[model samples]
Target: MKSSVNQFSTQFEWILNVINVGVHIVNKDGDTVFYNKMMAHIDGLDREQVLGENIFQLYPSLTDESSTLHVALEKGIETIESIQTYVNLKEKKITSINSTYPLYEDGEIIGAVEIAKDITKVMSMYDQIVDLRSQLAETHKKNKFFEGTATYHFSDLIGSSPAFQEAISLAKKAARTHSPVMIYGPTGTGKELIAQSIHNVSAQRNQPFIAQNCAAVPKELMEGLLFGTTKGAFTGAMDRLGIFEQANGGTLFLDELNSLDLGLQAKLLRVLQEGEVRRVGGSKEQKINVKIIAAMNISPDEALERGIIRSDLFFRLNVVTIQMPSLLERKMDIPEIVNHFIQKFNKSFFSDVRGISQKAMQRLLQYSWPGNIRELGHAIELAFNVMDTGEVMIEEHHLPAYLFPSGKYSVSNAQSHHPPLKDKIDLPVVLEEMEREMIINMFEKYNGNISKTAEALNIKRQGLQYKLTKYGIEKVYAAGSKEPK
Candidate 1:
C-alpha cells in the first residue's frame, strides 16, 4: 500500500508540472511544497530553485498582506479572479488574474494553491485594438478631405454653449504658438474636431498635418511609426520615414496620448525637448520641427492618478491646454448640434428630413448621453434611416429603439404631468436636479467613497465634488475611504 501511494504522488506531481496554467502550492508554514514548471516560467524563475523553498523568502516583495497564497493559507479562505500586479524577483513587472484557495486534508487546512493566468499579453492586445480603431477613424476622416487640407475649422464647430465657446477660444489661442498643446475631454466630446481646427488655423496649416492615435498601434509598430525604421532593423525592413520626419515643419496630432507606454512617452518627451528623432536601428539623429498636439479622452488629473501619463511628459505637453465640456454640461447646444447633423445627413443620404420635433428633442435631452455628441449624431442618423420618404419632421418613433426601450411616448403622455411651457419651466434647473439626483444615488451606492463614486459616474473626483457642492450635498465619507461595516 505504501509503495502504491508513493507512485501515485509522483504521477500527480508530474501531471501538475505538465499543465499549461501556472500552479503554485505552499504549505501551512508558507514553505513552497510544489512549484510547477508552468508557474516557474510565468514567474521567470527556475523550477529547481523554487521547489521546497520558503515563498516569502524567495519573493521578498510579497508579504502576508500582499500575497493571495499567504492570505489563503493563513486564513483558510478562497480568492477568485483577483487581479494582482507585482515586480518579480527578476525585477520584471508582472500582472496576472489569479484564483487561490486553501488546501484541506481531513477537514483541516494544510496548504494553499494558486491558479494564475497571465494577462499582460491580453492587455497589450486590448491596447493595440484601441489604438487601431482611433487610427482607422483618423484615416477615414483624412480620406474625406483633399490630400493635405484639414476638414474641420473653427467655424465648423457646431455649438453655441459658453462651455464649448470657451474651449474654442483657448484652442484658437493655442494655434498661434509653437508650443505643444494638450486637449482633454470625455470620449465623443469632439476632441479631434478641436484638434483639427487648431491645426487648420496654425502657422503650419499648409504643411503636412499628420495625425496618429498613440493607442491605435502596438508598441512595436508605434515605435517604428513615430521614429522611422531602417532596412536592417528587422526582417523585410526597408528604410521608412516616421511621423516625426513626415510632419517636420508641420503639426503632428497624437490623439489618446495617455495610451502610450511610459517608456515610449519618455522617448517622445526627449524628442520634443531636443527637437530631434533617431530612426530605429540607425546611428544618426535627424533634426525635425514638429508641433505636437496631444489629446486624451480622460481628464489629465485622472490620467495622472491612473499612471496613464507621465508627469514630465504631461508638463511638457501641457504648455497650452483645452478642456472640452461634455454634451451633458452643454445641453443647450443639443438643438443646434442636432440640426447640423440633420443637414449633414440630408446631404449625405439624400433625405430631406426637415428637423426633429420638440417631443423627440425633449426625449433626447432627457437621455444621459454616455457617448456625448457622437452618440447624438448616431441617434439622428439612425432616425433618418428609418424615417418614411415624405417624413419631414423626425418624431419620437423615429428615434433609435434603445433610446425608448419601454415604448414610444405619445406627445400627450410626455406633456401630461408637466406644467405649460407658458409658465417657463427652467430647463437648466430641471437638468441640474436630475444631475444632482444621479450624483447622490451613485455616492450612496459607493458608500460615500468619492473615488469609487466618481469612477462609477465616469467623471473626475474634482468634478464630482464640484457637483456635490453645487447641490449642497455632503459626503458621508472622504475620497478612498472604506465602506462602513
Candidate 2:
C-alpha cells in the first residue's frame, strides 16, 4: 500500500511539472514543500530559489486574508476559479485564476495545493482590443464621410430572371426601414450580397456596417462577439463593444443565422424586440440604434424543423424576409452573368479574352451548379487561368475538369462532347475550338508524343497529325508550352 501511494505521488509530481498550469504546494507549517517549474516561471523566481522558502517570504503581498493558498491552509476552505492579481518576486504584476484546495491525510489537515492559470498576457491583449474598438466607435460618431463597410450596392446584383428580380424587389424595400430583415437561400446564392446591398442603399449608409458569419465563428465566442463584454466578465475579458454596438445606427449583418445555438437565438430575439443590448456578464442594458439583417443558408421552415433555429426568433426577423433564387432556378440569366464575369476578370487579369465559346457556354448552362452564383463565378475564374493568352474565347476544355463529373464528357469523348446548340450558335466554330483545345491539352499531357497523343484522342496517328496541322497547334505548344501561336 505504501509503494502504491509513493508511485502515485511520483506520477502527480511529473504531471505538475509537465502541464503549463502553475502548481504550488506547502506543508501545514507554511513552508514550501513542492514548487513546480511552471509556478517558478509564473512567479518570476527560480525553482531552486523558492523550493524551501516560506510562502510569505516568496510572496510578501499575500496574507491570511488575501491569499487563496493561505485561506485553504489555515481555514481549511477551498477556493475554486478565484481571480488573483499580485506582484511577483521580480516586482512584475501578474494576473491568474486559481483553484486552491486543502490537502488531507487520514481526516487531518496536512497541506495545501494551488493550481493557477496565468492570464496576464491574455488580459493585456483584451485591453488592447477594447481600446481599439472604443476608438472606432468614436470615429464613426464624429466622421460623416466614414460610410460603413458594405461595398455592394443594388446595381451589383446581376441577373435578369423573374425569380431573381422578385428577391431583389423585396430586398430594396427592406432598406427603406430599420426593421430586422431575414434573407434565406441555398448556399452561395448571394444572401450576403443582398444584405450588403441593403445596407449600402439605406438611410444609415454613412454609419458603421459590419458582418459576422455565424458559421465561421466558433460557438463559444459568438455571444461575447455579438453582445459585447464587460470587464472581468471571465478570467481575462475586458470591457468591449460587440458587433451590435460597433454597428450602432448602421447595419449588423449576421450571415448563416441558423448556425447560432437556440440560447443565443433567444437572446437575439430579445434584442430585436427591445432595441437594447446587455454585455456578457454585465448588469446594465444599453440602447443601440442598429439595423439587423440576418441570412440563413437553408429555408426557415427547414431550419425550424431541424431545431436549428428558434421559432420565436424566426417570427421576429421575418418582418421583411427575402428568399434568394438558386442559380439553377435562374439558369436563363447565365449568359449575362458569364459576360459580366468575363468583363470583370478582363480588368483584373489584364487579359483581353473576348468570351466563352458556344459549346463551353452551353455546358455551363447544363450544369446543376450546386454552389449557385459562387460556383458560377469560380467556373469563369478557372477558365481564365487555363485559357491561352491572346485567345478570344474560353473553350470547353479550359473550364475546370471538376465541372465535368468523372471526366466522362470531356473533349476526348468527342462523339458526346457537343452541347445541343440553339439557332445562333455556329456549329462549325464551336467544333473547331473544342477540337483545337483537346489536341492542345493532349499534347501537353503526352509531352507532344504523336503516338500517345493520337491514342489518347482515340484516333490514328496520321489523322491526329492532320488535325493538329489543320488547327496550327503542331508548332506553338508542341512540347510543354501553354502559349497560343
Candidate 3:
C-alpha cells in the first residue's frame, strides 16, 4: 500500500511540472481534486492554498449553461472555448483562455478537466498591428490620389477660361508625342498639375510618373537624386535608383528648371541628348526610357536674362511649350474655381455650407490674386472653417484682409477720381511700371525697413537697393529719412 501511494504521488508531481498549459481537475460534484503548478502559476495562486476547495465556491457562476465545466459533465463530451477571468489568492486579476471537457472512465463521466493559457501579450500585439495597418491604409490612399494626378487636367483644375482651354488643348496634343515638353507659367499657376495630367493621359500612364521640384532639391543631393547610386556609394547608402531610373518608360516632370545649379545643368543636358544616366558612384551609364517634361515659372526671355538655365537645355525642352495662364490674366475662371474649392472644402470638413454670398463672390473676383489658384483654394478653406453654422454664407468681410486690404479698397474707391491715362505702352514698359509700383508699395508696407522688405519680397537687400536707385526712388531714403515717406 505504501509503495503504491509513493508511485502515484511521484506520477502526479511529474505531470504537474511538465504541463505547459494550466490544468485543473474536478470531481463530478464540482470539487477540486487535482491542480498543477502551471495552473497555480497562471492564476497567480499557491498550489497548496487551492487544495480541497470547491470549484464553484471560488467561481460561483460555473453552471452547465454558462460554464464549460458544467457543459462537459451534462453532455459527457469535450467542451472547448470557455472564457473566464479569475482573481488569484494574491488578489490580482488575470484573464485566462479556458477549455474544459469531461474526464472519462471507459464510458462514464468521472469528473472534468480544464486547460488554460495566458494570452495577454498575444492580444496586445494583435490590437497594435490592426491599428497600424488601418493608419497605413489611409496614408496609402492619400498618396495614390495625389501622386496620380497633376493640376488642371481633372475636374480639380476648376477653370474654363479661354487661355486655360487653349493651354490644355496644346498640352494634350504634346502629351500624345514622345518629345520633350516645356511648361512656362508664373508662380502658383498649376504648372505641375498640367505636367501630371499630360503624363496620366499619355500611353505610358501605367508606368511611374515621377514629379520632382528642381528648386526644392538640396544642391549636394541633386546629382544622386537625378542619377541613382550604387551600393555604399555614399554614407548610409544601400544602392538606390535615382528619379530618372525610377521614372523609366514614363514621364519625369522637373519643376522650377530655372533653379537648377549651373554645373549640374551640364549633366541634365547630356541626359536629354543621350537618353541615359550614370549613377553617382558607378562608371556604367544606364539607359533611361523616361519622357522629360520641364516646367519653369519664369518666361524664356527672363530666363535668358537671368542666366539661371542653360541655353542648350532650353532649346531641347522648348521643342514644345505649354504656357499656363495666370489667374490674374484669366479672371473669367475665378467664379468656377471658387465654387469648386467651396464644394471640396465642404466635403472634406463635413460642412453643409452650400455656396458663397454674392458680395463674397464679387470680392473674390475683384482681388488681384498674387498666389493664383492655390491662394483662392486656401481662402475658401479658411472661410468655411471660420463660418459659425453648418450653412456657411461667405461674405465680403469673411475674406482674408490681405485680399481686400484697406489701401486697396481706398484705391478702388478713388479709381473714378483719377481719370484713366491715355498711354498705349508696350508689354515690357507696362511690366516695368507695374514692377516699380509694387516695389514702392512693398517699401511702404515694411515701414522702409530695407532688410525686412527685401526678405518679404524674396529679393536680396542689394538687389532691392539697385532697383530703387534705377527707379529714382533712392532719393526718398537718401534725405536723412528713417521711413519711406
Candidate 4:
C-alpha cells in the first residue's frame, strides 16, 4: 500500500509539472510545499528558493488579506479567477488569474492549491486600452476644441472608386445626423478610418470619439470596460466611467461587433434603447447622450444568421448602414493609394524614396489583395525597411515576394523557397511558412535584436517571443538571447 501511494504521488507530480499552468501548493501555515516548474518560471524563482517558504515571505506584495492561497487555506474558501499582482522572489512584478481552492482532509481543510495563468502581458495591454479611455475622458474636460484627437476625415481618405465613394457618401450623410450607424466590410478596408471620419465631421466633432475593437478586448474584461466598474465590483475594481459615459454627447465606435458576446450585445442594446448605461456592479443607471458607430467585417445578415449578433441590437444600429468595398473591388484606386502610402512612409521612415516604379506598381496590381489596403501599406513599409537608405524608387524587388508570381503561396512557390514543403498543399501551412520566413529575415536585418525586430514587425516583444517559441527560431538565432527577458 505504501509503494502504491508513492507511485501515485510520482504520477501526480509528473502530471502537474507537465501542464502549462503554474501550480503552487501551500499548507495552512502558508508554507509552500509544492512548486511546479511552470510556477517557478512564472514567479522567476527556483524551486529550492520557493519550496518550504511562507507565502508572505516569498511575495512581499501580497498580504494575508490579499493572498488567495492564504484566504483559501485559512478560511476554506475558494477563489475563482481572482487577478493578483504580486512581486515574486526575483522582485519582478507578475500578474496572473489565479484559482485557489482549499485542500480537504476528512472535511477539515489542511492546505491550499493555486492554479495560475500568467496574464501580465494581457493585463498590460488591457490597462493600456482602458487607460486610453480614461485619459480621453480627462482630455475631453480639458480640451474644449475637440475630444480625443481623431485625424481621419472625408477628404483625407484615398479612394476615387465608385463603390468606395458610395460608402464614404453614406458615411458623410450619417455624420450629418445623430442616428446610430453601422459599417460592414472586409478586414483592412479602413472601417475604423471611416468611423473616425464620420465622427470628425459630426455634431459630436468636439466630443469624445472612443473606438474599441470587440475582438481585441478579452471577454472577462469586456463587461467592466464597456460598463464602468464600481469600487466593490471585484477584487481590485475602482469607480470609473465606462467608454459609453466617457463618450457622452460624442460617438463611441465599437468595431468588429460580431465578435462581441451575445449577452453583452443584449446589454448594449439595452443601453441604446434606454439611452443610459448601468455600471457592471452598480445599481443606478447613468443617463448618457452619445452617438453609436459600429463596424463589423462580416455583413449584418450573416452575423444574424450565425447568431453572433443580437437581431434587436442590429435594428437599433442599422439606421445608417455603409458597406465598405474591398480594395480589390476598387482596383482603379490602387495606383493613387500606393502613391499615398509611399509619400506617407517617406516621411515616416525619413527616406527619400520618390515613388513606386511602373513594374513595381504592376506587381502590386497583379496580386489579388486578400489583406487589402493594410497589406499594401505593410508591403510598402517593408520595402522601405529592406531598401538602401538613399534608394529613390520602390522597385519590383522592393515589394513583398508574395506579390510576385514566383513567390505566390501555390505549390510551385512553396517548392521554390522550401524544398521539403513541395508535397504540402495546405494554404495555412504555406502562409505560416511565409510568416516564419518573414520573421527570420527581419531578425537577420536587425541582427537578432528582439526589440528591433518586434518593433519593425509592429508587434510586442512578448508577442515576438511567442512567435520565436512557436517557430523554434530562438534556437537558431542566438543574438536575441542577450536581450533582457
Candidate 5:
C-alpha cells in the first residue's frame, strides 16, 4: 500500500508540472516521455495530444531535411534557434521561434527539448528599430557634408543669402537631371568644389570625375588631348586614349571654357549633340557617354557675341547653368572661410597659428579683394611667412604692398612721410631694377617660357625685348650662362 501511494504521488507531480508553459520532455523513438504546459502553449498541442505523438508528425515543419532538430539529432551536440510558421488545427497561421537542444540519457541520445518564446512582438520591434536606424543613418549622411568623398549631399551646402542659396538650390535640382552643367563664376569662388559636390551626390557618384583646365593645354594640342589620335598621327605619336574617352559614364569638368579657341567650340558642340567624337587624324567616330560640367567666368552669351565660343555650342552648354556667387557678395561667410583656411593651412604647413585677430578680421572685411578667395589664401600664406607669434594679427602692413596705399591707390599728401632725394632715386634705374626682378620672377613662374611670360604680363614682343635689354636678362638659357644680374 505504501508503494502504490508513492507511485501516485510521482504521477501527480509530473501531471501537474505539464500544465505550466515550459515543456520538459525526453522522447525515445519519437514518443514523448515528458512534457510541459509551455511546450503545449507554443505548439498549441495539449499534453495528452503531444505525449505519444511522433515529433515530426505533430510539427510537420521540423523534418530531417529542413529542421534544426534534425541537425541537433545528427550532430548530437548542435543547438539551433529557428522560427517556424505554420497553420494550427484551427486554420490560424502561427509563427514561433524554437530553440531546440538535444537531450541525452545514460550517455546515449534520446530526443530533443524545444524552448520557444513568442518572439513575434520581439521580431516586430527589432524590425522597426532597424528601419529607424537606417533612416537615422540616411539623415546623418545627408546632414554631414565635406566629411569625405562619400558623405557629401545637397543639404550640406552652407549659405543664407538668396543669391547664394538660389544657386545651390539650382545646383541641387540640376544634379537630379542628367544633363550638361555649366558653372559661371570668377576664379576661387569654389567652382571645382561645387562640381565635385554635385558629382558626389549625383547618380554617377561611383563613376569617374575628371577635371582639366582648357587654358592649361596648348591650343594646337587641344584636339589631340580631347580626342585620341591614331598611331603615327604626329611625331612620336603612339595610340593614346583621350580624356573624354576616359571620362565615359562619368563627369568631365572643363574649367576655363572661355579659354578654348572658337575653332574647338564646333568640335565640342558635335560631341554634345551627337554623343560622338572623331579622333584627330582618324575617321572613325566613337560614341562617348559623358556628362559635362564646364566652368568659366565669361558669360556664354557674351562669348557667343564676341565670337569666342560657337553659338551652337553655347546653346548646348547653357542647358543648365549654375552661377557661383563671388565671396565678396557673401561677406558674412568670410569669418567662416577664414577659419576654414586657417585650420587647413595649420594642418598643411604644420604651424600653430590659432586664429586671426579682431583688427585683422576688420582689415579683411574692409578690403575690396580683387583676387577674391585665391588672394585671401595667398595673403594667409604670406602672413605665415612673416608671423612670429601664434596670433595672426594681420595688419594692413601684413597685406601685399600693392593692396595698400603705396600701390595703385597711392596719392601724394603733404603731411605724409616722404623719403629724401636719395630715397626718390632715378626712375630709369628704379624701372630697370623692377624690370630685372619681374623678368627673373616671371621667367621662373613661366618655367622659362618666353611667349607665355610675356603674354601673362601683357607686354608686346618688342616691349619685352626692350625690358630684357634694359635689365640685361638672358635671351635663352645657355646651360651654364648666368640667368640675370
Candidate 6:
C-alpha cells in the first residue's frame, strides 16, 4: 500500500507539472508544497527554489488578503476568474486571471490549489489597439478641415415637440457647466447629435471634441483606450496617451456607455471622481480636465436593472440626465425630418426632388417607426434614389418595398373613391373582410407556403390555417403538405 501511494503521488505531481496552466498548491499553513514549472515560468521564478517556502515569503508583495491561495486556505472558499495584479520578486508586474479552490482530505480542509492563466499578452494587444485608435483620433483632430469640427450646434437640433424641447432645455443648462452629462434615448433618436450639440455650446467648444462608441470597441480594449498605457506594463506595451488624455480640456463623448463592461465602468467612475487616470502599465496617475458626455441607447434605470451599468457610475454620470424622446414620441416632427432628409439627399445625389406627396406623408405617419429618426432618414434616402430625373415629388412608389410589404398601399394606381354610405356601416364585418383579404394576399405572395405566409403575416401556421378555414379559403391549402395547410 505504501509503494502504491508513492507511485500515485509521483504521477499526480507529473500531471500537474505538465499541464498548460500555472498551478501552485499550498498547505493550510500557506507553505508552498507543490509549485509547477509553469507557475515558475509565469512568475519568472525558479520552481526548485519556490518549493517548501512560505508563499508570502517567496512573493513578499502578496498578503493574506490579496493572495488568492492564501485567502482560499484561510477561509476555505473558492475564487473563480478573479483578475489579480502583482509585482513579482524581480519587480516585474504580472497580471493573471486566477481560480483558487480549497483542498480537502478526510472531510477536513488541508490546503489550497490555485490555477492561473497569464493574460499579460492579451492586455498588451488591447493596449496596442488603444494606441492605434488614439493616434487615428489625433490625426483626425489635426486635420479638422477634412473631418469638419462638429457643425451641428444647438440651433441645428430640429424638433419643437414638448418632450424634445424639454430635453433640449435640460441639455442647454448642462452645457454651461463642466459636470458630467448622461443622455439616454432609443437608438436613432440622435443621442450622438445631442452630444455634439452639447460640446459645440460648452465652455470647451474650441478645444478637442472626441466621440467614441463603446459598443464599436471590443470590451477587452476599452480600459486601455480610456486610460493610457505605459511601457513594461505588459509584453510589447508602450507609453501611449488614451482618449481621456487626448480630449483634455475638451469633451469626451462616450456613446452607448452601457455597453462598456462593468469592471471597466468602475475604472471610469474613478476617473470621473478623481479627474485623473493612470496608464495601464505605469505607476503614476496623471490629472485630466475633460468634460464627459455619456450616451446610452437604453435608459439608465433599465441598464442598472440589467446590471450592465454600475450603480455607482450611473449615479456619478446622472448629474445632468437628459432623456431624448424617440421619433415615435414626437411624431409631430416627422414632416420636418422628412424635408430635411430630402434636401440632404438632393445635395448628395444632385437630384432635384422637390417634396414628398401627402399620401406618402400619411403612410409615413401611419407606420410605427421602430428605428426612429434614422429609419425615417433611410426611408427618405431610398425614395430619392428611385425617383427619376424628371420626377419632382417623392411619391409612395419611390418608397422601399419593406415599408409596405403587404402591398396595401401600392402607388401603382390612384386612390379609389368609395361611394357614399346610405346607412350605418358594419365596421367589424368590413374589418374582418380586410383581414381575410390580407391573409389571402400573403398566402398567394408566399406561393401557398404556410410557414412563410404565417411568418410574413406575423402569425403562427396553425392560427393561419384556422383563419383560412373561417374565411372558407381552406381549398388554398393542400392536405398533409407544407403548402398553406
Q: All candidates' TM-scores?
A: 0.58, 0.64, 0.57, 0.76, 0.53, 0.60
Q: Which candidate number has the best TM-score? A: 4
lDDT of 3 by residue, 60-138 (tens): 4344465567667777767554445445556565555677889889888989998877654543443343344334434
Candidate 2 CA-lDDT value:
0.79
In the range 254-303, model 2's lDDT, one tens digit per residue, is: 98888897888999889988989999989999898989899987788889
Candidate 6 lDDT by residue in tens digits, 225-335? 788767655333467888898888788999989889888998899999999899897888899999999999777888988899999999998899999898879999999
lDDT at residue 384 of model 2 (Cα atoms): 65
Candidate 5 per-residue C-alpha lDDT over 1-485 given as tens digits, one digit per residue, 9 for 90 to 100:
99999999899767756553355454646566666777667666778877777666666644564444555566675543454455444444455556678878897778876655554454444334334433443444455431323344555455576778888878878788689899987666667777877887787776666677887654655676677666656422346566677566667789988889788888888888899988777889899888799998655676777777776777788889998877678877778777767777778757776777775677688765534566566566655554445444444444333344434222231112321222222355334434555665676566556677788788875466556533434433322333322
Candidate with better lDDT, 2 vs 6 = 2
Q: For candidate 1, lDDT tens digit of each residue in 262-366? A: 889999989999998999778989999988999997789989998989999999999999999988899999999999999998898677788888889988998
Clashing pairs in 1: 131-215, 131-216, 132-216
Runs in model 3 deviating more than 4 A are: 1-152, 235-237, 407-450, 454-485
Residue 101 accuracy (lDDT) in model 1? 96
Clash count list over all predictions: 3, 0, 2, 0, 5, 0
Q: How big is the positional error of residue 475 in model 6, measured in Å on the Cα after superposition? A: 36
What global local distance difference test value does model 4 have? 0.81
Clashing residue pairs in candidate 5 are: 20-37, 20-38, 21-37, 21-38, 22-38
Candidate 6 regions with alpha-carbon error over 4 angstroms:
1-148, 405-485
**What is the Cα root-mean-square deviation between model 2 and the actual structure?**
15.0
RMSD of each: 13.3, 15.0, 24.4, 9.6, 28.6, 15.0
> Global lDDT of each model?
0.76, 0.79, 0.70, 0.81, 0.63, 0.77
